[model samples]
Target: MSIKEQVRQLWKTCFDDDDAFIDLYFRLRYTDKINKVIEEDGKVISALQMIPYPMTFCGQTVATSYISGACTHPDYRARGAMRRLLQETHRAMFAEGVMFATLIPAEEWLKGYYARSGYATCFHYGLVKKVINSYEQPVDNSVSCLNMSKIDLLKTPQERIYPYFYEQMNRRPCCVQHTPDDFHVVLSDLALSKGDVWIVDKNGVMSGLVFCLMDGNTLSVKEILLSDEADFAEVLRQLAASYRAERLECIVPRADEMHELGMARLIDVASCLKVFSAVYRGEGLYIRVTGDEAIPQNNGYYTVLPGKVSRDMQEGQTYVTFTISELTAFILHDLHPYMSLMLN
Candidate 1:
C-alpha cells in the first residue's frame, strides 16, 4: 500500500470518526505534501499534517501551520515517535518561514502533552444558548434568507457569499483567515455533518451570515458574522424555528467566560515581535526569551521599537525575561484572538 493508505489505516486505528467523515477528510483536506509520517519496516507508524493557513496578526497576514490529524499507532505510543516527529516538524516550519504553529488538542490530557512542546493555550470561545420566546417579530421571509449546504456551495454563485465571508473573517483583530480553498473544505465538512450556512439580507443588502450544524434537537453554530445593523436575535429565532430545534447554541468569541479551543506556538520570534511592535507602535521594550528548546533560534534577547524588532542587547536597557509560553501569552494578551470554522 501507498503512504496515503498507510496513514489512512493509522488514522482509522487512532480516531473514532465515522467512515464517511474519514472519507470526506481524506478527499478534501489531505495531501501528500502536507503529510508527515514516521515509518518502521516501511509501514507508517505515526503521522500528522502541517496544513498551511493565514492568520491576521498585528494588522498583517502572517503564515501559520496548523497541525492536523495528529495520531500515532497504538503500538508506537510512548515510544517518542510523536515527540521526535513534532520536533522535526517545528524545525521544518521555522525554516519555511512559518510564523506560528497551531493545533487543537484531541483530548484534555493532550494539552499538557503539547505544552511540553512549546504550545501555549491561547484560542478561546464562549457558548451562547438561546430559546426563542413568543412575541418576537417573526422571520421575514421577504428578507431573502437562504440556507446553503454542500450542494448549494457547488451550485450557488460563490461570488455572492465568498467576498462577504472574506471581509467578515478578516475583520477580526486576531483570527485565522481562511482562503477560498479552506472555506470550501469547511463548508464541505459542515455538509458532511448535515450543516447549513444561513445568509440573511435586509432590504436586499447582505447583513447576517451563520454557519451551523444540527444534532438531534439542537442547532450548534460554528460561527456567525453580521453587519452593524443585523439583528442576531431575529436570526436565532429563524434558525430555531426552521430546524425545529428547541435549543440553539452559538459559539462566540469572548475574552472571559470561554473554554479553551486551541493552542499556539510562536515559531519565528523576531518576526512576531516585529508584528507586535508594528501594531503597538511607539512602544519601546526589551525582551529575553528562554525555554524554547524545540526552536532554539527563538531563545535570545530582543529589542522592540516603533515598527521594528531586532535581536540585540543594549547597555543598561532593562529587559523582561520570559519563557516561550510566557512570551506567547504576553504578546497575544488583550488581542481577543479567535479561530473557528476549523472543522475541529
Candidate 2:
C-alpha cells in the first residue's frame, strides 16, 4: 500500500470513516508542502495536514493556515508523536511568515487537547436553530432566490467590483477570505463539502444571499447576508421554505451559548499582530503571556506597540497577563467567533 493509503487506514481506524470518503478527502483538500508524518517500522502512524489560506483581519488580508485532518494512530497515542508534530508545524509556520493557524476540532472536547500545543479558542461556531414558523402556506412576497452560475459571478461585474466584493466579505473583524477561484476549487472538490450559494435578487438588484447545506432534516445556513433589514425576514422565510428545512440554524458571528463550535490558536503572536492595521487605542501595554507549559518558547513577557512587537522587554510592567487563548481573543478584537472560512 502507498504511504498515504496506510495513513488513511490509520485515520479510518481511529475515526470510523470509510475508504471512499477518505479518498475524496485526500484528492480534494490536501495542501502542498506541509504534510508531516511519523513513520514507525515502515508504516505511517501519525500525520498532520496544514492547509494555508488568506484570512482578513480588520480590513487587511493575512496569511493563515488551517490545521485539519490531524490524527494519530492508537498505537502511537501516548508516545508524544502528535505534540511533536504540532511543535514542528508551528516552527515551520513561523519561518514561512504565516501569521496565524486556525482549526476546527472534530469535537469540542478536543480544544483542550490542542491548547497544549498553543492553540486557543478563536472561532465561534454553532447552529442557529429556528423552527420554520411559516413555510410557504401564505408568503409575504416573492423573493427570487436563485443559484448564480460561477461564470456569471466572475463576469458581469464592473472592473473594480471584484476586488470590492472580496474585500467586503472580509470586512468583519477577522474573517477568512476566498477568491473566485477558491470558491470553484472548493465546490469542484468532488462535492465533498456540499452547499449551494443562493442569491435573492429583487427588482433586478441582488439584495440577500445565503449559503446553506442540508443535514438530514435540517438546513444549516453557514452564511446569510442582507444589508437591508426590510429584506431580511422575507429572504429568510423564502430560504427556509425553499430548502424544505425542518429547522433553520444560523451560525452568528458572536455566539451566546455555553459551548463553542470551533477553536483557534496562534502560530506566531508577533506575526499575527503585525498584520493588524492598528492595535486598540493605547500607549502600548506590556503583556506577559503564560501557559503553554508543554511549549516553553511561547511563555514570555513582551511589549506590544502600534507597529512593533518586542519580546523579553524588562522595561515594561506586566500590565496585561493572559493565557494564549486570551491573547488570541485580544488579537481578534474580542474573538467573537464567526465562520473562519470554507463553509461551502
Candidate 3:
C-alpha cells in the first residue's frame, strides 16, 4: 500500500470522531503541508504536519517550525508508522534549517513517548489567579496604562516596546527567543484582534504591558510584563477592576523568576507539573527516583520509569528505571494508579 492510503486509513480509524477530524483537518490545512501525506490504496495510514513561525531571539536569527498533528492508523501503530513519519519530518525540518520544533501533546504519556523520539522538556508554567469583584482603577491615581486601542502598530516606535518586551521575557526560564521584529508582529496581531492592551508608562516611556481578553464572564490575560518600578499587582488589579471579571489567568514560568515583576503567585505546583509533563519525553525503562527530604503534599518531584510506574521523590534524587511507553502512559494519565486514588 502507498503512504497516502495508509495515512487516510489511519486518520479515519484513529480519529473516528467527526469533530476531531474536522479540527485536525483545519489545522493541517492551515500549515500548508497536508498534501505532503503519502497515500497507498486510497488510504492514509500515516501523516505528518508542520506549523511555521518566524522566531527571533538574542544572538541568533532564524525562522522556526513546529510539528503537530502527527498520527498513524491503529493497525500501523506497532509497525513504526509514527517513528518513520517523525524521522522524515525531522529530516525535512533540518533541511529547511529550522531552529526547533514544539507542540502541545494530546496525551500526557506522550511526553515520554516523544522523549524517546528526541524531544525534551525545556520550560513550563501554569495558569492561576484569584477572582476579585470590585477594585480601584490604577488610572485614577494618574498611572498611565496606554490604551492599545488608540495606538497604531505601524506608527508606534518599534524601539520603544519591542526591545523592552523581548528583554523582559528573556529573563524567564522557558521563554522562547524572539527578535524585535518578531515581537512586533506578534503584538500587532494580538492588538488588532484582541481587546484593549494596557501599558504602564514611566516618564512618557513604556515600561510594562498587559493583554487581556474577555470570554463570556471571565477575563483572560494573554501576557503581562512590567518594569521594575511598575506595580504589577496594581496593573492586574486595575485591569480586573475595569472588566469586573470574576477571575484573571495567564501562564507563568515554573521558576517564578517573573513573579517579582508581576506580583503573581504560584498556587498549585502539582497541577502545573501535570500539565507540563504532557509535553516532555524521556528514555530507558523501569526508572526510579528516590530523595531524602520530606516531599510536600502539593509540590513534590517524581521519577518516571518503565511499566507506567512513577516513584515520588522525597529528599535526594532517587534512581528510576522504566520503559518509554510506560512513562508516556503515566504522564498522559493513561496508566492506572499504582497506589490508592485517595493518595493521588
Candidate 4:
C-alpha cells in the first residue's frame, strides 16, 4: 500500500471508527497538513498528522501545529516508532519556527503517551451530559422574536463564514485564531465529514452557530458560537431535534466546572513568551527553563520584561524558574480558558 493507504488502514484499525467518517476526516480536516511517519522495511509502521492553525494567546497569534490521528500498527507496537516519530516532528516544528504543538487525546489513556514527549494540559474542558430520556424536543421555529435557522454550511457565503468565525472566536477567550482562508479550508473539511453546522442569525446576520458530530443517536456539540446565554439553550434544543440526537454531550459547559480538553507543548519558549510578553506586566524577571533535548536553546536563563526578553540576566529583578513543561502550563493558566472543541 502507498502512504495514504497505509495510514488509512492503520487509522481505522487503531481507532475503530466508521471507515467513511475517518476517510473524510483525514481528507478534509487534515488538508495541507504535514504528515510524519516511521517506516520499517519500506512499510509505514506509525504515523502522525500535524495540522497547522494559528492560536491566539493574550491577544497575539502564535503559529501552532495540532497533532492528531496518531496511529501505530499493532504489530509494530512496543517498538519505539511513536517516540521517534514524535521527536522528529517536534524538531521539525521548532525549526520551522512554530511556537506550539498541541493535541486532543481520543482516549484518557493516551494522555500519558504524549506527556513523555513534553506536552502539558494547557486547555481545560467541561462536559455536561443529557440523558436520552432527558432530552426535550425543540419548539416551533417562529416562537421566538429572534429569527434562528439551520442551513448547510456549504450554503453559508465566504464573506459571512469567515467574519462569523472571527466574531465567535473573539467572543470566547483563548481561542485558536482563523483567517478567512482557514475557514474556507475548515468548512470544506466539515462538508466532507458530513458534519452538521447550525446557525442562529439575528434578522439576516449570522449571530450564533454550533458544530455537531453525529453518531448513531448521540450528538457531540464540538463547538458552540453564541452571543448570549439564551442563544445557547435555543441552539441546543433545535440541534437535538433536527439531528434526532438521543443523548447530548456539550464540551463548553459553565466556566467553573471546565475540565482539561487538550495537551500543549512549547516548541519555542522565547518566541511563545514574546506573544505573552505583550500582556505580562511585571518588573524585569529572571528565569530559566530546562528544555527538551531536541531544542537546545529552550533550556536557559533569561531576562524578561513586559516588552523585552534577553538571554543575559538582569541586575535586580523578580526571579522565578520553571521547567519548560511547567512554564507552558503556567503562562497559559492566567486566561482560565477551557479547551476549545473546534481545535479537536
Candidate 5:
C-alpha cells in the first residue's frame, strides 16, 4: 500500500474519532514540508509523521521541527515499527539540515525509549500560577499594571513594547529562541476571539507582558515576562480578574529563580517533582550532542538534559553523542520509548 493509505489505516485503528483521525492524517500527509513512513502487512498497521526539522523550527531562520501524531497499532507494537520510523525520520531530518525537533511525550515509558536512540533530557518545566478573584489598588510605591488587551500591536507604543520585552527575557538562563514573527504567531493563536496579550505598565511604560490562551475552563500561559517579582504577581491578579478564569497557569523554565518563589503560590511542588522524577530515569549517563545551534540549558547542566537521562556516578556507563535534532526528539518524546528502555 502507499504511504497515505498506510497512515489512514493506522489512524483508524488507533483513534476512535473519525474526524480527529482524518484531521491528523491530512495534517501529517499534506504538510508538504514533512516526510511520511508506513509499516504494513496485508494492510497498513503503523505509521510515522515527520517534517524536516530545519523547516519546521524556522531552522533556516531558527533550528528545529515540531513532531506530532506518531503512533503504532496494537497488532504491530512489538514489531519495532516505532523504532524503525524514528530512526529513519532522524536520518532524514539530519540530512535536511534540521538541527533539532520537539514534541510532548505521550507516556512515561516513552522517555527511556528515546535514550537508547542517543537522545538526552534537556529541561523540564510546568504551567503554574495563582488565581485571584480581585485586584488590589496600587499603593503609593506599588508598580503600575496595564492590560495588553487594551493596547494595539500596530500602534507605535505597542511596537516599542516588544523590543524591551525581548531585552528583559533574553537575559534569562533558560529562555527559548523567539523573534518578532514568533511573538506574532503566538499572539494570533492565543487571540482566537478573546484578547490574549496583557502588558504590565510601570510609570506609563511597558514593563512586561503575559502571553496566554483560553481553552474552555483553563488559561494556558506560555510565558510571563516581567522586570521584577512584584510586577509579575500583580500581573497575575489583573489577568485573572480580566479573564474571569478560575485558574491561571504558565509554563516556566526550571532554572528560573522567580519560578521557585512563585511555585508555592502557583503549584504543589511535591506533585510536580514526583511526576518529573518518575518520567526522568536516565541519570548519570553522559552524552555529547553536535548541531549547528545550541539549546543553552542542555549545554552545561547534568540535571537539565531535556529528557529523564541524568549523570550516572557509577564507575562505568556508556557515553553517547547525538545530533541536536535527535536530542530535541528525546526531550519532546517524539522518538520511540522502547529505544531508550535500555538506557534506564
Candidate 6:
C-alpha cells in the first residue's frame, strides 16, 4: 500500500473516528508534503501531518504548524517511535521557517507526554451553554441569517465569504488564522456533520458568523465571532429557533471564563523573542532556556532589550532560567491566544 493508505490503516487501528469523518479528513486535509511517518520494514508504524497555519502574534502574522492526526500503531506503542518522529518533524519545521508548533492532546494524560517534546499549554477557550426556552426565541426583524454548506460554496462562491472570515479571525491579537483552503476544509467537515455556517446580517452588513453542528437536540457552536453591535443572547435565540435545538453550546474566546484547549512550542526562539520584544518594548529581561532536548538550538542565554533580542554571552550575570515549556508559556501568558475552526 502507498504511504497514505498505510497511514489510513494505522489511523483506523488507533482512532475510533467513523469512516465518513476519516474519508473527509484524508480527502480534504491530508497531503504528502505534510505527512511525516516512521516506517519499520516498509510498513508505516507512526505518522502525523504538520499542517501549516498563520497565526497573529505580537502585532504581526507568523507561520505556525498544527500537528494533526498524530498516531502510532498499537504494536509500536512505548517504543519511542513517536518521539523520533516528532523530533524529526521539529527540525523540518525549523528549516521551513515555522515559528511555532501547536497541537491539542487527544487525552488528558497526553498533555504530560507532549510536554517532554517542549510543548506548553498556552491556548485556551471560553464556553457558553444555554438551554433554549420557548420564550427565548425572538423575532428580530432587523437581523437576517444566511445559511450555507459545502455545496453552497459552488453557488455563493467562497471568495465573498472569505474576506469577512479572514477579517474577523485576524482581529484577535493572538489566534490561529485559517487560510482560504483551510476554511474550505472546515466547511467540508461541517457539511459532513450536517451542520451549517450561519452568517448573521444586520442592516445589510455581515455582523457575525457561527459555525455549528447538531447532535440530537443539542447544537454545538464550534466557533462564534461577533462584533460589539451584535447581541449574543439574540444570536443564540435565533440559532435555537433555526435548528430547533433544545440546548446550545458555544465556544467563545477567552473572556470571563476559560478552559484549556491546546498547547504550543516555540520552534525559533530568537524570531519569537524579536516579535515579543517589538510588541512589549518597555519590558526587558535576561533569561536562560535549558530543557529543549529535542531542539538544542533553543537552549541558551538571551537578553531581551527594548525592541530587540540578543544572546547574552556574559558568563557571570545573574539571570532567570526556564525550560522550553516555561518559556513558551511566559511568552504567551498575557496574549490569551486562541484557536478555532481547527476541527479539534
**Every model's TM-score:** 0.93, 0.81, 0.53, 0.84, 0.55, 0.93
Q: What is the lDDT of candidate 1?
A: 0.84
TM-score of 5: 0.55
Q: What C-alpha lDDT, on a 0 to 100 scale, does residue 11 get in candidate 2?
A: 70
lDDT, each prediction: 0.84, 0.65, 0.49, 0.74, 0.48, 0.86
Best by lDDT: 6
- lDDT string for model 1 (78-180, tens) is 9899998999899999999999899999899999999888888989998888765542454456553543222265566666788999998888989988998
Winner on TM-score between 1 and 3 is 1
RMSD, every candidate, angstroms: 2.6, 4.3, 13.0, 3.4, 11.8, 2.4
lDDT of 5 by residue, 1-344 (tens): 65665666666677565564365346433353464565465665655555322211111123444455667888778877777776666656555545444444555675567544444554355446666444343332233434444455334344555686667655543234445644544444344334456666766766677766676655667676776633565566666656666677766654233221100000111222223344445444455544423222233213323244343333454546645435444433431111100000
For TM-score, the strongest prediction is 6
Clashing pairs in 2: 124-337, 128-249, 128-250
Return the TM-score for candidate 1, rounded to 2 decimals: 0.93
Sort by lDDT, best first. 6, 1, 4, 2, 3, 5
| Candidate 2: worst-modelled 10 consecutive residues by lDDT | 147-156
Kindly provide the TM-score of model 6 when superposed on the true structure, using C-alpha atoms.
Answer: 0.93
lDDT (Cα, tens digit) per residue for candidate 4, span 1-344: 77877887778778867766675566666543488888898888899888787776777766888887888989989888898888899899998989888888888987887787788787776776775654555556787645556557777687855677687687655766666766766676667667777767776666787777787789888778777633666677767776667888877735445677788888999887777777789866688887577677788877778987887766666567777677778877777544454534
Query: Model 3 over residues 255-333: C-alpha lDDT tens digits?
Result: 2332211100111223323334443455522233222111223223454333233435545554454232233333323
Model 5: residues >4 Å from true position, as ranges?
1-30, 39-45, 51-62, 126-128, 131-147, 150-195, 199-207, 214-219, 227-230, 255-344
| Prediction 3 global C-alpha lDDT | 0.49
Model 2 TM-score is: 0.81
Identify the runs in model 6 with alpha carbons over 4 angstroms from their true place. 135-155
Q: What is the lDDT of residue 20 in candidate 2?
A: 59
